[model samples]
Target: MPSELVFCHPDGGIYGLQFPMSNSISQLDISTMKELSNFVNLLSRHKNLSSIDLEFHRKGDVRAQRIINHAFSLNVQQLTIACLFKKNKKYSHDERVAFPLSLSGSKTLEHLSLRGSCGLFDEEIVLTSAQRFSSLTTLLLHSITLYDGFLSMCPNLKNLTLFSYRMTGSPVLRISHPQLSNLTLEKGECFTHTVNGGRFHVSAPELASLHFFGFCPQMFTTGDGFPCLENAHLSFHSRLECISGSYAPTIVNLLQQFRNVKHLTLSMEIIERLNSSEELISHRPCPLANLKSLTLLPEVATFVQHKHTRVIMSPEVQKYLLSSSPKATLTEVLTLI
Candidate 1:
């Protein structure tokens, strides 16, 4: 019979793998479970092992915890969990799988990728029992729900990607890094509630690139500690019937935050829609003097502007930047409009 798990090496040794599910957990006979347990033990003892990938199919937290414990018991550097269960109208019954908090014991772990369920935000995963992942540097978490404390504990992480299934308040994040870089958010995760607990939430700094699902005029801010982000790729959906002028303050405040940003990319996707060059370019805002690159969907470039006025960089701002760092700052200036 073919094995459910197999590891091969052409050189024929240093190691190889074959394992059976724990106990009689497999769909097959009991003998294989014993064989599988032995293989898992061999894998745990293998010194060269640096990573493990797990599939949680039972939709039960108990089994998931056992498998994760096996991986953590090893000095694994990376772990990836593919969660096959999804939450639908059935609700509570489907959320029994292991939450993100249950897998925190891998002290040497450097990278982690998670999917399936609303695990990260599960209320049962208590933070007090969680151990600090001293060496973790990268994390990718996708869920139907996520909250502030998810990142509050992972202090050493450098690169991170977060995706949420539905819209929710922007969970505050406080990051500390000496040489960290990339950051990304997908879908509804980009929208944040600035007035959470009556205080504005901030994101990580030293981030080089930021990508979101839609354009958020509220994302830009004048807050004293906001990141002077360098590159941004923002997406947008067509505005249908919004309360006219209802978004003015949010829009203004958002753009003001990008005062120090340099490169901006805006994307607007339309289904079976045709737009003219003028209509597209008109909405694009005037480029800042410090901006080195600008990209826009045709409608935004045509419509996003200071009413009928031209979108041009101010001469004073350009001269000031050129005087400070001509080689790095003044060498490239692009006007998309």
Candidate 2:
């Protein structure tokens, strides 16, 4: 009946811990902006505090790094930084906010995520910075640039996602993690591409899931690209530009490259606003063959409904869209809207 006595058998399932402390627990709300530096310092001694998530908004630069560093001292296993920052490219370039990229507090961090800040880091800073997070397995960063450091140093990385991945130069990638299974890429400025003479390689072989938010789906490479991809997600935004040869034409190849993909998540913008007229999509059959799940959000349905908006797929085209792939059987699908 005591919390300390609660345990789970190795071959058995999870066991619930029961608290034995006989005391009235006072409700302390941290959201009220309590000045609890002393309390926080006390909790810092708890070695069991291995995982922590933080969201800071409008809380004017309150020594965030220190709080984070303290959490590491408490054996934090996971750390997520979701800060609110208006677009400030100059500040990111001038100030090394993105520097000290690694966690100095807990050298044993397994997961780290930095998101929701625009223009806080440059491409080179993140790439070549000295890293102490040798135990990291999962990493997610947004509003920053990635360099070769991300690709080369993160040998233990299992899952990676870069939201708003804005890089200036073409960085060499040497990713070869076998445990890597999931990948998610979000929107960012166009990565300044350098002339790549070598082939695109994936050192990882266990990758099974992938999601591209605001991806230029038209990028199709043939040899040794996306060999083990199973599920793919494409999330489109309103401001997303749909160039003819790049995005539109590339759709065929993307569908072809991941020919065996089972699930496909099409963002509303791609499904709806892509065609000047809905009629364009009416004729083209769904390309993916092994697709089993199709998520049609409300936005895509709304885009298909507009009359002057082009050829929206009617029941006839809808049938063709589904039947296009013999293996493209959507067993559990979402017709949102």
The most accurate candidate by lDDT is 2
Q: Which sections of candidate 1 miss by over 4 Å?
A: 1-36, 86-101, 117-130, 165-180, 189-200, 215-228, 238-244, 268-287, 298-337
List runs of model 2 lying over 4 Å from the truth. 1-44, 55-62, 85-102, 105-107, 119-132, 168-176, 190-203, 215-223, 236-241, 248-250, 266-289, 293-327, 330-337
92-133, model 1: which lDDT tens digit per residue? 753443334355566788987866554533422212234567
Ten contiguous residues with the weakest lDDT in model 2 = 9-18
lDDT of 2 by residue, 1-337 (tens): 2232222222111122222341232323332224346436555555555555554443234444455555556655676665443433556454544433344534678887765555435322243343456677898877655665455555678898876655534433344677788877655333443211112235555677877655353343434455677787765443334423235445444555665667776655444444433444455666555666665443333122433322243454345345655555443234443
RMSD to truth, every model? 10.1, 9.8
Candidate 1 deviates by what RMSD?
10.1
Against the reference, the lDDT scores of all candidates come to 0.46, 0.51
